[model samples]
Every structure is written in structure tokens, then in C-alpha cells.
Target: MSEIIRRDPRAEWIARNRLHPLHAALQSQNQTVWIGPNGIVRKNPHAIAAGFIGPAGIKRIDRSGAQQGTGTRRSASVEVQLPLHVVEQPAYYVAVVPDMVGGRLSSHDKDLLGLARRLAGSEGAVLAVVFGEHKESAFDSAGVDRLLLLDGEQYQGYAPEQRVLALRAVDNQFAPRHWLLPDSRTGGGELGRRLAASLGERPATRVWQAEGERCVGRAGAGQQDIQRPLARLILAAAECAEPVSETRHEARPVELAWQVARNLPRIEDLGPVAVDPAQIPMAEAEFILSGGNGVKDWELFHRAASALGATEGASRVAVDDGHMPRSRQVGATGTWVTARVYLAVGISGAIQHLQGIGACDKVVAVNLDPGCDMIKRADLSVIGDSSAILQALIERVAAWRQEGRRDAA
Candidate 1:
């Protein structure tokens, strides 16, 4: 990680521009570290499929009374604009590749790119993307230029620590004024904070699409709403002193950026991006799925999970076992996912693991021993083979699908 040397205590003078230095500096230090690789994605503006893990729409089992298939279809489509990718100038942009779990140029990425193209001032942009573990990356496979790939060792799996190290390495080497990393989980937050600390400055979190929209955050256990007059991420600094026309060549880089950040949206504005949770004391989410030791090979584990629509998650065991992405892994050293419903499968329910996700609303356990401590902690327990339970669950979903078909006819 790039260490930001603090401002020399002996220095008698400092520049006003230093307030927003091109690079991140450690608090009280002169060392400035580059930070970012903002992972972006797009919102699918058009119609999409429902249910099952597949592209677009998933096919449903058409029933004629028996357990068979029909050539029928489901009517599901969302309205969307023609997808176009634009480019931003020197705005700090990094291209991150998603693993099998992710894909290139998702809808969110497209939208982010659109924003860069539409709003960025010239020469104020930089681009880098994280391409997940791939034998041949977009850099090698295509003639596409301007896409920087972070293929560090952590690229193969979701190794948060490793990724932090790699990001620091890039910042020190590239010297890009601003770094943009993924705004996903706590690991990303940890990296941002640690990176800012190394640089010696309180990092600037969650940038905005346009200027004037302030992003105010609240810290408490209640519900509130912060409405935006414009459709954009709040808390942005406008490089352009004056408002310019949309067609100005100086603005709009969405089309070119889409190739790298597929998950972006088609519009130039976005909702308020979140500040890294690591930097502040905030309540965690209200629901989580704690994947404990019960997760066998990635197949049986997630396969059984797919049978249920709950967000599939993992404990440190799953990550260490390489069964789940480090991003999904939960524990003390990892993220804390607090959900209303938490399912602990095969987890020993070790205090360390529980400490990470114990704030769950309802706990469910599927363990071999009905008397396991986790079972006691759970609101419901099924004393049987966890794998068998999953298989049965899958069978039930299949049956439900059949029933739905019959009801429709």
C-alpha cells in the first residue's frame, strides 16, 4: 500500500491547492498516495428475465399436467435506451473485471461511463478496470486501448487483503492523481481507509455526478429520506466553473467508458454513492446469510443456495476453501452482514464467526446435530444432512413451478 508521508511539521508554509491535493496524503504527513479504481456498472433499462441464474430471461417449465416442458414463455421486459459507450477525459477511471460471478460492461458500468462522457472536463480523467481471474484478459484478447486491468494475485479469487496491496502498488507506480476502487463491500472500505491512512489524509469518500447536490449522511437506527432535485450522485465538485451544453465535446464520455464499466447506467446522473462503512460508525445491514462449514464444494453449497433466493454468503471457511469469493466471506476480519434472516449452514458457529454476523434478525440452522450450539441460537433447526435438505428444497421449488403452471392453465 502507498504510504502518504505526512506534512513535515517543520514546514512553515503550505499551498491552498494542497487542500485537495492531486493525490491522497496521510493525515499530518507529506506523503501523498493515489487511491481509486472505482468499479462501475449500469442499470438494465430494458426488459429482463425473472428467476434462475441465466442471461436475460429464464425459461419456465411449461406443464401439461405431467412433469414435462412446454414451449411457452414469460412476458417480462424493461424499457431501455439504445446502449452507447462514451469516454471521459482525465477523470480517474479504472476498469475492473468481474470473475465468473461478474461480467464485462454490465448495465451499471454503462451508466457510469455515460456519466463520465457527459459530465467530465477534458483531460481530467483516468481509466482502470478490474478483470476477474481470466486466462486471457481483455487487454490481451482485444485491441481495445485505455483499459487498465488489475490482475494481481487476488484477481483469481476475492482476496480483499491482496487486492488492497495491489491497489497500493498501482497508486505508487501509476501516480494517477485520483484512484477509483470498487464501492462494494467492507473490504473495499477497509482498503480505502487503510490506503487513506497510509497517505496521511482523511480520504474523500463517495464522489458525485454533478456539483451543488450535497450528500448528507445520518447515523442512527431510524428511517429517513434525503431526496434529490436532480438525478445524480450528490456531494460533487464541478471542475467546470460554468454550465455547458450537453453536446459540448468537452463533456460526455459515457459511450467509451461502457466497455470497461458494464454495470453503469445510461444516464449522466446517479444516486448518492455510499461512504465507506469502515470510515464511520454505522449500523450494518439488517439481514445476512452466514455460510459456515456446511458449505462443501462451491457447487453443492451455492447450488443449494440457488434453490433459495436469499443472498448466498460465506464464512471465512468458504473463502479459505476457495469455495466462495472473498467478497462474500463473513467473519471478524471480514464483512459484517446483518440481515433479518440469517442461515448458518455447516458453520461451527464459532464465536469469531458469530461475532461477524450475529446481529441477524432470525437464525436458521441446518446441521447434523440438532443439539449444536448454533442450533440453539437458531429460531428454526432441521436435524438432518444439510445436503439432503438442499436437494429436497430444490425438489420442492420444482414442484411449486409445476403447480404454478397448472394454475395458470
Candidate 2:
């Protein structure tokens, strides 16, 4: 019979992440000795009491349970549910229009919500106005006090004119104190500008920091910061504020009083055009499959990227080696990407590379060296050969597509 050893990634991640809600509980359950919050070493007397006097003068602890004939199994981890932070009646509303890219909240969206939460601050409610259908189910965790979803065929696709009309309707009904939107290229920025124009309110664009009465934003070419009084409409940049992790919100449903009036759009979206992954700008790409010097199979890497519908990126080393074009390079010296998911293959993360992907929501690393800097920075890391990993990923993606096709048929 073969002995099987199972590894729990979630437990491992929780153990490594000290900020996680269940981190302390997991640590207490696993270890007898740990450093306290005040930098003092604390020991468990119960764990020490488990030891007994051996045949000699020394006290012994049977960790393997050889004497007991059966080894003790570790207990399962219990889920730690956060306490709800509810607001039954809000004095005012701080509206947030998130750029729900890929039908989910991006890191930028979360940051914007955090800022809204701060602005709302007990008396005011954080209203998240979502356009079209969304796959997001964590609005409470995202610090949403109220959710207003405008889902219809007209709201779908690139319809800035229609969206502005909807915002106008929301403005008329709710009369929110402040309007917050993600200042990114992914429709949010444009929508915000349009809404601001429609409302005749001067918006603070590229705002990175906002507190009581004052807001700080980047000036021309990202060289200087312009600090001014908080405006009614604010277009916030990424990392405007830390995401809501400590508390949960009520996330009550909100409805519009009347239907939004629609007008004929001058700019027509002729559906989506099929552009090559390589041609897509790295900064705009939602998902990126990047390669490094450790990647031995460039063809296989490209195949994997194609299979996964991911834009291609390369580390500086890979670019210098002529494996990929200079445009495909992703780093501080190259293109800084804000991809939602950055899958790095065989990249021993350079400082510049890490800086470039600093805005990325999630990073997954595939590498042979477990102690590499990329592995440490990655949300999820797979220690293995890059070639084998890419091949397996391609196969998995193919199988998933085939299954989808079968279901459709």
C-alpha cells in the first residue's frame, strides 16, 4: 500500500498570512511556541504537559505516536465568519461606480469602495451602482452598504451615453453626496467624465488619496500631485485606499424610482473585434501569461497563452534574449501592467518586475525554485518545471473548452 500525504494550500496560505482572520486560530492550533504581539515569546503549558518521563532521566514527547500505536490526525480548520456591519437608515449616500471588468470587481474597484466606505463613515451609506450582469457575490465583504444593479441589454456592451443617462436618473432619485468611480481606461474613467459633464460637476480626476474635505491626485504625466478640496464627483486611481478586509457591510438592495431615458448613441459598438493576444497592450490586458529566462519552451508557452486566451508578456531577461519582442516586456523599464491575474512562468522576480506587477490583483507563479522572490510575492505558487506546468495547463484548458462545447451541444 502507498502512503498518501495531502497538502492544504488554504491552511498554508492562512498560516503564512498573519493579517488573515483565521491566522491566529490556525497558528494557535498548530504550534506550542510563538511570538506575542508585544515581541515576547509565549509558550503553551498544555503542549508542554503532553510530555512524559522516559526510561532515562530525560522527558520525551511522542510526536509520531509510535508507543500509542496510532498517529493523531490534525483537526479540520473551522471557517471564521466576519461580523456584519449594518446601516438601517443612512443620512447620505456616497455612490461608487466600479469598473466591473470580466463581470467581477477588480482591485481598483475594491480600492474605490474602501474610499467610499471611509467617506460614508457610519452616517452615510456606500452605494455600489453596478451596470450589466456581474459575477461578483462578495459585495458585503467589499464594503458595500447598498447595491443598485442596472441590468438590461441596453446597459450591456460599450454604451457610455446610455450609462450616463442611468447615472443621471440615479442622481435625481438618490441625490448621493459624492460620486466615486475608478479612474482607469476600462470604461470607468470615460463614464465618470460623461457623468460629471451631465451633472455639471467638476470632477477630481486621477485621485489617489481622499480624506475629509481634501483630495490628492496626480497632475499631467504623473510627475506632480494636485491637492484640492474634495469635489462632488471623484475619479480615483488604483490603490486610492486599502480594500475592506476587517469588517463586512449590510449590502442592502436599492432600486431606481423611475426608468432611465435612452438616446441614440453616436458611437456604435459593432460588437467586439478579434485581436491577437500579442497585440493587446499589457496594461489593458485583464489576464497575462508571462514568461522568464527559465522558460525553455517558447512555442509551448505561446500555445498555452493562446489556449488560455491570455495576453503574452516576458521578463526583461526573456526580452533581452530575443525570445520575445521589446513591447511584450513587462517591468518598470518596460510596460507596467495592471492585469487582474498575472501568471508568471519561471520568473525569478526582479525588483523592477515586481514593481511593474504591483498593481496586479492576483499573481500566480510557476517555478522550479521554491525560494525565488516571485514565489514569495505570488498569491499562489507551484514549484515545478515550467515546461511541464505549461503543458498541463494547456491540456486542462483544452479539456475545459471541450466540456463546455459538449454541454452546449
Candidate 3:
């Protein structure tokens, strides 16, 4: 009797697609050992099913997927360059002021840019007005047609008055058809209101939809929808429109025609005050250390979070078990976080939890189960005991802080 081999091309394709929703699960099943881009070899001990016991009762192990002469492997390193959307001589401009939190564009900022692109249409340009020093390097992909940087000492810190002055100067030069800003607590909402007051233009607030001449926004505590003619300025809510993913823009730099007029400072610029990570709101947190059912030591977990300077988050099960407060829970039913780094310890990565951290830039998972959902979504995965990992992490962070102090001395 001969053996028959089977192949599933669809499964292989899904495994190679990093953007697919099932990518993590499919890859976890198909791969046991793989080389990362940094030349580090990662192995999944639980996925070592490449061979079976022979008739002689001798176990066989094959690194290659070739079982019974039928196996396939594929890579997902091919980069697809989007088509360029060029506006040579724009008839008008739709200026957008993004809330570049932590010197980089947030998901809110990108959503606002997507709305700006819609307003610009085919003939007009999307002018991005940036403030202070920025670390963003992908302006072209973010759909910026004209980049206007207002980087100055005056624009730094909590200077809404100074920012309004710069925006007024932009108004005099470009005279854009419309102004768009994010309607969040982050600097954008306040700045937009100030700009509207400074320019004496009635602005639409909490706007979610915009079309040819009319825009719809939330009114009366978000229970009612008000439709009105599009105002000169608009403060849009998050998810106003889909982000620009199909096309790239020029991101051409533009300079102001004249120097910005300065004014007497009313608010003194005091340096930032250090706040505890647990006190920070989940939506506004930049780094999070989350724990799940696999975490056995709650006291050590808290210590590790404090040492790492990360906001504490917990899984639904942890919260239900009274291990953490409901406010610190991270999932679809809980607060959605847009942290730059989300560290999950012993989490199985529920669908709701993954949805909550979908906007995070990086996800690092520490778990005993290599085939867990969290490991699939993690940018880096460490298969180990949660308590040991946390203890080592706390020690490492303490040593790093001590070295820094010594260097200063």
C-alpha cells in the first residue's frame, strides 16, 4: 500500500498574508521553526508535527514541510507600492491640523487626514499643518498633499493661544476653503474652537459625515443628529471615514509667505508633571502592561508594571475574578486603547481584546502557550512562564535605571 499526500493552497495563502484576520492562527499551525528578519531563529515547540513514527517504531523529524513528497512554503516579504495621487496646481486647499500626540500621528490624526482627502476631492489639495518637532516619516502614505510645518519654540507646550496665532497667519496666506481637526480631548478640539473664534467663523463640532454641501454631526449630548450646511471649520469625530490606504500623495513642503505675528504670552510654559501610569486614562496611555488568567502573582505583576512605567490593564477574566478593577480592563466591552506598545502577559488574545488594541503600533506577548491567539498577533512573542518573565523584566528595568543614574553622576 502507498501513502497519499494532501495540500491546502488556501491555507498556505492565508498563512502568508500578514494583514489577514486569520493570519496568526494559520501561521501558528503551519510553521514550527522560522527565521525572522533580524536573523534570529524562532521555534514553536508545540507545532513540531512534521513527521510521525515509522513502522520500525523509530520517530522521524523533518524540518522541511515535505511529507510524503508533497509540501509547500511561501514568504510574505513582497512590498506593494501604492499609486501616487498628485495634484500639480490645486484650485484650492483644505487645511488639516493633526493632533500629533507624542510627536507622531495618532490613529485619530490619520482618520482626520482621510476625511481631509475626501474634502479635497480631485482638484483641491490637502494641506497638513504640523506643530512642534515631529518624528513622523511617512507623510506621503498618510495622504498629505502639502506639508506646512509650524515648528518653533512658541508652538511647543500647551500654547493654544500661540497655535491660534500661527493658524490665523496660515488663514491670511492660504485662505483654505475648509479647516478640519480631530474632535478629541487631545489638543485638536480646543485648538479648532480657538481658531474658529479667532477667525469669527461658526464651526461644526462632532461631525461624523460630510458630503457635497451638507454635513451631519452629533448634537444634544450625542442623542440627536443635526444636519446643516458645511461650515468653514469642522471638528470631526473618530472613524469619520476610512483611512487613505490605496494611494500615496506628494507631501510637498510649503513655506508661509510672511513671518508669523507674535503676541504677549498669557500662559507661562511650565514643564510636564510626572503622573503615575495607573492614574492615566487607558485611551490616552502610550504604554500598557496587561495581565491575564495565566498570571499567578498579582503583587509581582503590579511591581513589574511600576518598574516598566506602564499603565496597568487586565483581561476580562482577571476583572471578573476580582483581580483588577473594571476600569483597567482591556477589551471590546472596555475602553479601546491606542497605545504605542501593548504588552500582554499570559493572555490568550480574545477577539474582543485584539479589537481593543487593533490601533496599537506594537504588541508583545509573553505566554506559556506558543499557539495562543496573543502570540499570533504579537510582534514579538516569548514562550515562557509569565512569573519568571515578569521577574526578569523588572530586574532588567531596575538595572537600566541604575545605570542611567550612574551615568548622570
Candidate 4:
């Protein structure tokens, strides 16, 4: 059997620009800074290339460092021209690599698989690339048509470089058209971005909706739409709410040769530390008590949450203000919670914040603003001072506990 070979354009681009500072930064694993051919310094060339002009398409100064024009002013605005050489025909399969959450497949993983199935349509096959030790039978129940298991000791860690290497190896052989990954911090978000850069494909991140080849999302507060070609890569900030039905499918297992990466930067694992489970954000916590900007007293919020024996979570505002660590942030940009009961104290409820708790069974909002979006969506709304309400609730709970103890005595 003849092995199929495919050329990676991004690898070629990096090889050609090996002498450039940007390329050097990539190799050294330092912050990426780009000095344009015209000597204009940019924080990131990828952003510039995507938004303004393609880096390879940029005109460079001559060896003498002189402009080609004779004192002619350059145009203020430059039109971006897509690279013609990097275009490749779309493959027949849509590839999905699910991110493991808490040592198992999370809702994000299921949603990514669902999206892949939708995008695959009728003709294309859905290829699921699973890493680490997982029940192959569980994936067989997923809507995936084919499963590629890459399991070994090296694949055990959450090293982004190792995951990228594994994915790259699979891509080299399969040449899949669309690569779907979870847009998560510990997941394939960074890996997807790196893979896109390495493959010279346009990466669409934080995609909320996919209409055919176009992905819809928000840039800041403004609506942003990215049109992906048939052969492009997509990193969806998965927001699928529909429960995936148990589908029986014959999953064909593919065995791909795995090689341990050499000279790659290894992510240092700060071994587990002993801490109160309630202090940390739990992905599978049943009851979550989250604080927002409205809560005046951080100490009181923590005390109340601890008293109630609920996992603590914070809004983006609270997290940004340093009231809480980012690990406990519950929002679109933070941890997604599927808790049975979510108590939002003082949170005004931005759409991004609400998106994080979409899977909650019931939402209880305690905010001064009765018309806040959070209050509107909340199953129970308490319109009052958040701190006062929290203090009263804590006192009442304490009183009940004391009364119960006395009666028992």
C-alpha cells in the first residue's frame, strides 16, 4: 500500500521565514512579536495578517533598506489578498478531538461531536480522535462514525505540544477538511490555534453558531462573523444545549503510529495540592453559590457559601476585580457549570455570564435590579441588597441549626 503524502503550508512558511524574529520567537517559545517588512512593529503578525494584510504577501524593503518609489507616499489602507498557494481541496471527513474534563468526556466534548456530525452532513464521515485512557464503548455510543484512539504514556499528560504532535500526525495521513476542537482553556483551544498556525489554515475561534461554512460569534460586544472555506479549521466555543440521544453506530477503530516528541517544550505539572474542595470550582458540583459585582462583602459571600456547603463561583466582573481567582469564574470565558442549583448573588447577569450556567436546573438570582437579565431568567428572584439578604439567610440557617440541636438535646 502506498502512503499518501500531503504538504503542510504553515510548516513551509515557518521554514522559509526561519531567520525572521517571529519565527525565532516561535522556536524559543517566547511571546510572538512581528516586525513588518516595512519595519513597522506589531504585537502579533497573525492578527495583523488576518485583519489587515497577509505576512507573506507583504512587500519588503530592498537589501539597501530603500523604498521602491521615489518619495511617493504609500497607501494608507491595504487590501488583504488570500494566499493562492495554500489552498487545498476539502477532504471527505470532519475530524473532532474531544477535550477531557475531570478525566472524562465533558458536555463540551459531546457538543463538539454533535457539531461535527451536523457539519459532516450525509456524505462526509465524522472522525473522532480520542486521547488518553477512555472507554471505547462510550465513544461507540456517541454519534461518531469512526474513532481513532491514540493511547500511550506520552499521551497521558495534558501537554499542548504532545497533543498538537498527535493531531498533526493524524492530519498528515487523513487530510481532514474541518478540524473541530473545544474552545476551552485546558482543552483544545490553544492546541487548535497552534495547529491552524502550523497547518497554514484560517482558525475560527469562539464560534457560537455554524451556518454551513460560516461561524458566528462576538468580538468584544460587537457581532462578528467568520466565513470558513471548505478546507479551513474551526475551534467552536461549544454552546450546544440539546441532549445527544443514544445512537447505536458501528465505530471503526483506527490504529495510528505514535512517536514521542523530542525537543518540545513540556508543560510542568504542579502536582496536586491539598485544599478544601468547596474552595475550588467543581465541574460536577450539584449546588453552586456564585457572587457578582453587587455583593459588597467578599468575606460574607465566602462565609455564606461555606455555610451552605455550596461550591463557590464568580462572575467575570468579580474575577477581573481580583475578588476571586479565574478558576472559580463562571461565564462564557470561564468554567461552564451544569449544577442542579445556581445561586447568583449580586450578579447583573451579562449574556456571557448566563451562557456559563445554561445547563443549570434552576437559577436563583439575588440582585437589587429587578429587571436584570439574570433576574428574568432566574427561577427565584430576590430583589434586595445582596449583602443584607445573604447575611439574613446565613443567620436564619444558623438559627435553624441551633434550634434543631437544642430540640435534639
Candidate 5:
């Protein structure tokens, strides 16, 4: 047997660092550093240093162009291009506000802010357009550079027409190049598609990554990953993780025009519908117990979910068979879940079903077939009849409770 030799990882790093453009630029003494749009180089080396170090670390360069000591930094001067006729000044960044159900910002909102911050970098400002009630402090703490609040009764509710009108008003004022909206069941995706059509611009849905002008995300039913430039109007659906602490900035309010508000078509407001917590939509459920084609008894499925304190969900087959409501269906053609824990019962796990549960933190599968797709995808798999396992689990849970009571006595 011949001995194998391993290449040092540092070799690749060394090669990459050597090929870096910044290294060559720094080495060239005659290389002029353009600060902004005009390509003007300042006489003061300190200003040049400030541009790279973000107006905080000012370094004193001697006559020989060597750093001597550090001094107080000043904000770098960069000129913004003014909007012209037919063409407008490109927006630094724009985040479209959706009506936050239950007066709370979801993970989508936090993710939008995160995406804005990443895109804005140091040169551009992060702008958020609010339609409904949102705390200025919340946005400020999230590091929003500018906030355009369209607060009033007119902007209230889940009216798509009203949202479109508000967005158009914002567009007329700012003409943002990039637009970020939350990817949720509540009208954001529809709003984005409609806005894109109305504005005659290309839109990207369910974007996960953004690099400079290019955004990469799933396109259609096949979940094909596509990349498109951010040069023109870019509308992206934000799918974000939990927010971390960011540097807080003061939020400046932008006023909405009274004429713009008045021009929107009148729509009658219907009051909120009463819904049972047990019957909560699967998409918004934290814990879900989902059944599929293999599940024979619908009552048993509901019983299992009730015992586990989970929301009831169903695969397309189960829904189509009338075992569950369409609202409870989890798949490409149904509601997408972001559940903390999803217990899949008797599901073979089609690609469409997997797509719906993409955001689920953990998946547990109970099926007779050990080689099933759901079993493969699940974190924990029980190779058994789903109803039998569910019944066993229910019995075990009841016994545990009884034991606890007996111990207390």
C-alpha cells in the first residue's frame, strides 16, 4: 500500500491572501484611492484612512506614507446621486412592512432587518416602510437607518389594495432598488408579486442569500435555486433566523401624504373572526402532529395530537381524502409550517410535503415502512404502525400522570 500525503490547509489560505486585490492596491504607492462617486482623492491621507476604517480609526501617515499614530476619526464624505427625470436615485435599502398579526413582529421581520443591514454595509442606509402599528424603538434597536411610518386607520387591516397604495406612495418618494418583504401566509408574497407586476420589475421569492447585487433562492415547485441581479427593482421574500442583538440607531419618521391616503379605494372592514386555539392554522403552529395517507382513522390522529398538545396537520392525501381540512394540509400546495417540533405520522414524505416542513426545527416520524422518505428525513424514526404507536404513547403519558398523582398522595 502506498502512503498518502496530505496538503496543508494554510497553503490554500496563503495563496488566497496573496491573490487579494487589496494587498496589491496597498503595495502600490502611486495608486490613488477614490473616496466616492466623483472618484476624487483627498489630499489629507487621514481622510483616505477614514474611508476604509469607517470614520472611527484615523491613522496619521508620515511623509514617507507610513503610519505614525492613531487620532480621532471623522465621518467620511460620500456624495449621493440625485434622482433625475424618468430615472430615480437608487435606494440604499428598503424593507416593506406587513401587517404583523397579533401586534407582534415575527422571525420574518427580524430577518428582513438582518438582510437590510448586510446589504446596506457601511455606504447605504437601511429604510423600513411601516403600514400598521410598529414600535419605533423596536426598529431603532434593530438598526433601521430610516423608518417611513404610514400609521392611521386607512393603513390598518389585511387589505392588499391599501398595502399596494401605501407601497406605491413610498416608491414614488424613494424609488428603492431593492425591496425586502416577509415570506408568510399573510399576504406579503402576494403583495410583493402584485407590486412587482404593477411596477414592471422582476421579483425574487423566498430568498435565503444575497451577495452584492445577486440574490439566490428557490424559484418554483421544483425548488430550483436561481440567482438574479439587484440592479433593477428587486423584491425578495425574507426567510430569516432568530434575531441577534445589533447596534441601535435613532429612527427618523417619514410622513405619508394625505392625498395618497385619500385616493385609495374604499373597502369595508369586517371584524375579526372567532377561532378555536385547538383549530389553529398549521402554518403558525409551534408543535404539529401531522397525518398522511397511511393514517386510516382520523379520530385516532386527532386524539394523538390532543394527547401530545400539538396542532393537527395533514399531508395532501389525507386532506384530499377528507380526513382533515384543507387549512391543515402541509405541502407545496398547502400551508408551510415553521414548527418547533413536527411529528409526522404515516407519511411517506413526498418532496412537496418536505418543502412545507423546511423550517421545522425537528421532525419525528412514525411509519410501518422503515425505508420511507419521512423516516429518512426524521430526526427520530419509529418503525411501527402510526395508530398503534400513538395509542401506546397516549397510554404511557396517562400512566405517567397517574403515577405522579399516586406519588403525590
Candidate 6:
């Protein structure tokens, strides 16, 4: 929305996950952390300076040698603060390198140079890799001028508007005229989308080249954001080409259905805009009663879950018995949840499963075995048969609900 800088397909950089090699390489040459308010890149000296140690102990030795507290700073030592780079000094391009399903591979310098030249268009613009992890160099090295980290706490998967948020965070960090992401499913499309929004603009679905600061994009929602499709443009680079385009040569911008692409602009004749329904999390209370493998019976868990106004979830064992939906599965290989109040029935807590759904405000476990891990982890451990516990709990819940209704009335 601010000023659209088209993707220089050729010169774009790729950050490969936790470590970004391109960024690292860039840092080796030009090191600076972006200071948001300044709109400038100040040098960070600490990065170049050697590591340090605290003051050493005094040695009480000879009378002539009166050793006291040792000064940590050396005679030739530099300042504690790191050097900063001038913002927009050297334009940087990005290449989305998300975590993928297979083996590792990297392109040649020539390939990078070619991409850098093509996308950056500007003399200073350089290509860098963008990804989730395994990119130590991108952060520490000098090849990449900037490293954009898309991973965050609220980040689950790049499904909808979340992608836009990621990109905005990066763009706000350092105002890059040209940012490039890969055209891969795993690439950071979500991040790009976020960047586009912060600039008060929508993204270009497909882009062929960038001449100077102007980006030529395939016509679509991009027209709404930029002066012209042949001018400046924004994009969520998802492929070597466009996902919506079948043929690479005749590649057009990816045009998703309005429902799929929530960020798409609303145009007249496009039909009325419909607001999406709110996502109700099953209950108003943050407290959640969960059914797990330990619940023992399918019918019982479901009944108790309904009474508790809770969504059914599963540990390793319950899923196998067909008690919970795959969506309701919870554990390391399952769902991650942070409920205010959590109650686990019949589950013997395994480390793997606990790792999955352990971040709850309060956890109550009712188990037949007192020695079970679940009991130990739970804030409240009520040892008994799961069935018996559920039966008792259900009665209390019914009474509680009735009382609540009466109070409301």
C-alpha cells in the first residue's frame, strides 16, 4: 500500500529457515540492524568486535604486587554497541525458503547473480534466501543484506491473513523497496501478503520483471494497489511462476476465489462482500474439559464432552479406537492448545503428548492409577476409574448449568 516495489525475480534472496544464509552473507559485507523510527541502517559494532569476559579476581600475592579488580575492557577494545548501516543504502531482495518435505539443495552464485540482477534491477539490490531454519549464514554472514524471520507465536500455518501479518513485520523492520519470496507452497506467501497490507496495498499475484523501482505485474487485484500493473507492484511470490498459472510462459497472476484470498480487493460487479462468520471456539469459558485415550469409552467421552460444553480431543490411544476425529487429536503429533482450564480423563501422560498440549492455565487429571504421569502433572489429581469420574462430573455439571440458568433468569 505504501509504495509497491515489484519482485526482481532474478535478484531475490532466500532465507532458509532458522538460519538465513543469504542474510548472513549480506551481513558479512554490510552489517546493520534496522531501527524502525530512524528509517536508517545504523552500524552494529558488537557483531564485528570480539567477545568479552567480566572482571577477574584480585591475586593476593607479593607485597609489591597489589592486584585488585580487573577491568574487562582491553586497551584496543571497541565500544559495546554494534555498528549500524544506513537504511536503503544497498537494496536487498528476498527468496522465500520455507521448510520443505525433502532433501537439501542450493543454487550457484551465477544463478543467484542472475536472479539478483533480474529482480533487483537496481545496482545495489542483491539476492538473499528466506526460510524458517537451517540458514546460519543469512543471519551471521554477509551475502544477504536483510534476514526476514516469518515465524512468530501467533503463527500456526500460512493459511489465510496470517501470511500478511508475517510480511508486514519484516517490511516494518526494514523498508525494502524490493522483497522477493519463492513461488513454493512452503515459501513465505503469508509474510508477503502481510507486508502488502501494511503499505495499505494488496499484492500482485504474478510478476515478471522490475524495471528500476517500478514492478511490472500481471493485471488483477494489483491494479487497485498500484498506479499501473506495469508500474510498482506487491506480491506473495509462491513459485518460480504463479500457482494459478498452468503454463510458465503464459503465466498470469494467481487469482484466488474471494473466499480463499481474504486479502483480495473488492470491486463492483464482483458481487457484494460477505463477512465471514466468527469462529466460535465451542464455549465462552476459557476452561476446557478434554477427552483423551484414557476416557476408555467413546459414548462416555462424547456424552461428558457435550455436558461440559467442551470439544473432544484425543491422545494416541483414543484415536485408534475411533473415539475422536483426526482434527480433535492432541499430542506431539497432534494439536497444540493453551486453554485456561484443562481436564484430562483417563490419560496417562506421555512426554510426547504432554509436549503437545501442556501449555494450559490449569490442568486437572482424574485417573485410576495414582502413579500415572498425568496425575503428577495435573494441578488437581482425582484418582478413580475414568467412567466413574465422568459419571460424577456430569451430575455436577448438570446442576451447575441449571443454577446458572436460574441465576440468569
Give Cα-based local distance difference scores for all models. 0.45, 0.87, 0.87, 0.71, 0.67, 0.47
lDDT of 4 by residue, 1-409 (tens): 7544555668648645633324534443232365544567756333322233223234332334243234432331664332221112334778988876554566678788777777866567778888887743556445677778877766666566777888888888777878988877765888898888888887877776787656665466546555454336888775642324434444567666656464355577565665564855557676899999998999999999877878999999999999998889998899888877899999988878888898886799999987677887799999999889989989998999999999999
Candidate 5, residues 147-234, lDDT tens digits: the string is: 7766677766657777787788788877665677765677677777777787787777677777876777766763688877653444
Give lDDT tens digits, candidate 6, residues 164-225: 54445444543455555433233435544544566666555454444555554445554533
Supply the TM-score for candidate 2: 0.73
* lDDT (Cα, tens digit) per residue for candidate 1, span 1-409: 7765454433313322222222123223322223323333422212112112122133333223332233332344532222223443344433222221133432223333433433333444434445454333322112112455554333444354455555555555445443433233533445555555665654433433333333322223324423333322212221212221122121121222222212222234344475432332223443344566775545665665555555666777767877767777676777765565677778766656667665554688888876556776688887877777777877898899899999999
Report lDDT (Cα) of residue 302, candidate 1.
Answer: 64
Q: How close is candidate 6 to the true structure, as a TM-score?
A: 0.33
Model 4 reaches what TM-score against the true structure? 0.48
Worst 10 residues of 1 by lDDT: 44-53
For all predicted structures, in order, the TM-scores are: 0.32, 0.73, 0.80, 0.48, 0.47, 0.33
- lDDT: the better of candidates 1 and 6: 6
Worst 10 residues of 2 by lDDT: 69-78
Better of 2 and 4 by TM-score: 2
| lDDT (C-alpha) at residue 27 in model 4 | 45
Worst 10 residues of 3 by lDDT: 72-81
Candidate 3 Cα RMSD after full superposition onto the native fold (Å): 10.8
Model 3, TM vs. native: 0.80
Best by TM-score: 3
* Stretch of 10 with least lDDT, candidate 6: 244-253
**Candidate 2: which stretches are off by over 4 Å?**
1-79, 316-322, 325-336, 348-358, 368-385, 392-409
